[model samples]
Target: MANGTGEPAEYEIYAIRYGTNETRLRGRNFILDARPDDPLTMDFFCWFLRCGDRVIVVDTGMNPVKAKKHGHTMLLDPVATLRDFGVEPERVETVLITHMHYDHTGHLDAFPNARFHMQAEEMAYVTGPWMGRRWFRHAYEVDEICRMVQLLHEGRVDLHGRDRAIADGVSVHWVGGHCAGQEIVRVRTARGWVVLASDALHYYEEYERGIPFAVAFNVSDMIAAHDRIRELADSDDHVVPAHDPRVAAIYPSAGVGFEGRVHRVDLPPRLP
Candidate 1:
């Protein structure tokens, strides 16, 4: 099938869960106030997108060592997990980094042959005044920034200033809220256009209730990003939240054994 624009009509999108933290804290994930007993937990994920001959990875998850040091239980090495999914990191040619947060940029070196696509403003924000604050600096790792710079020197970083298409059926839109250059990915899939809302909306509830996540660069921006996600996706089911554990239950499993760990987002979602 071909999209009217001559691109493949659909792509296969996979959400690979690499790590998770079961600890719950009140008021940590949502900006709105809740009861003292309200629970909040987060899952860590990296998305895999295959459109025609193009294989684009969104965010190379944090390495196991750093994940453990930061109190997150590393389920599996993301690069190794990708290999299990039949994707060889060495052969991957394009990597779309939604932002430079530690969890999202830690394993950049794994994809040695790839050109990293990132928002130019995100690079400036991480390297500029915001980094002077401990709060902002704490979310990123110095080594990852160094590696990205090295890649830049090697002529492998493709910086985009705003929304643009990376391939025939794949595009990225910048939504600066969770971070200065946070962006969400939109891909044409069998179910229609699916938006990978990478931290733009951490959970379905965030989008449903119009509440911004607690950790945000700009609350208003976060809320606006939610709106943008809704506009881009085919429907609510077509919007995949980055850290929502419920996604595993909602989407069909990729394989029999890796039921909750890996999901096939390219397929039509199973309704409640």
Candidate 2:
């Protein structure tokens, strides 16, 4: 997928918001300044990447049943949303699992033919002894983890040790912090390299203000991951935060009627 210039072909990256949690946490997302009165809410998103003939999917959004169980409002079926965007979920060959969080891995079954790419350490972290503790297990669903194990046996799982390129212009980097094996995806786009900081940096403010998210396996690693995200992206604008509503406002809409629900990150932003 190289261009005439020998660089990997630039891809189109889209961030699709499928759900939101309106329950205000009041400054719970950021550490070090627990403002109990400052309300905080987060949007749930899954990213899509397209390059010529190849299509790659980032985290799969949570299913409606699970969303309701967890107090999140599922806006739309992510698979259906992809179909609306002209991507057939069944035809997608590569699915990137940033981490094992329930929201990110819930729809794995939606892409039956895709090989799931995940950090090797992440799989170990989630299935290892740490999960025995309720705090660690609370964020994950046992059935999903078990299904991944089943997929591994079926030869549908691809695990990587660290930073690895999944495609011509797409790569995943292990920045273990939010979780022991949390990763961020980077892809070359028309606007340059865009880094999808999935959960590694949930909000733009988390990276800009040097504040770690409240739930982190390693605070020092989270801080280092922030640096890595900046280094990988062309600029701050090229770094897409996972849960920030501002992403929808900053990027151009994918199409008319898709405003706020689907934003095109690969294209130049509509707002400065």
Candidate 3:
């Protein structure tokens, strides 16, 4: 990861956990798994990327109202957490919205000053006829979707196809499976290229076991995305799953006061 000057331009990455849903079961989470209904807990997170002065955020995360509606335990406000992490919402220059799912785009209004980078297909999926069916639109919030539409009208949304580089050491790649516009982030950190497998690979085991998440728009795409995540990351160990509670448990804390909730992803994971 080098800049225009040919110097190492590695960014620091942090994963900030904000909410959790503990009602999930293996029967509900893994669409391909035929195992018994074992309990599973899904945690919510939004990632932060920093290289020198450049700041980029991934996902806005679900707001209080939306979290409560879905029975998610809100641990911290995403906006507040970012502020406490020393990045203000008013100053963020770019945001990578993984998808338009309700939990991902709930608080988009908070980052009005930045250009929200998202897949063109995602914008179309949310507004297209496919969303008329309840199953396809179950994870999306109409209010947040409308807000994105408003942002598009306001010219605050940057929509593209396939993939694009967001910064010198950061890029996003498309892998539409969980949804029409699902994407994952590939970041160049000091250790290596870390692929933030947003909802495309919610749990670490999802890819390891070759299983698809149940709440998906295309099962085939979901299964195929496992390969894409590997292609983007430097190694399988560098890939970070967004919804796994194990992430917060094993990864070292980012800094003081953020223990158990925020951890530094650029550092190597503490394996047993």
Report lDDT per candidate. 0.86, 0.89, 0.89
Residue range 149-186, candidate 1, lDDT tens digits:
88888999998987989887789999999989999999
lDDT of 2 by residue, 53-162 (tens): 67899999897888989898888788998999889999999999999999999899999999999999999998899998886778899999999999999999998989
Candidate 1 global TM-score? 0.95
Candidate 2 — which residues are off by over 4 angstroms?
3-7, 32-34, 270-272
Over 174-253, each residue of candidate 3 has an lDDT whose tens digit, in order, gives 89999999999999888999999999989999888888888899989999999999888988889899899989988899
How well does each candidate superpose onto the true structure, as a TM-score? 0.95, 0.96, 0.96
Model 1 segments beyond 4 Å from truth? 1-9
Collision pairs in model 2:
none
Q: What's the true lDDT of residue 227 in model 1?
A: 81
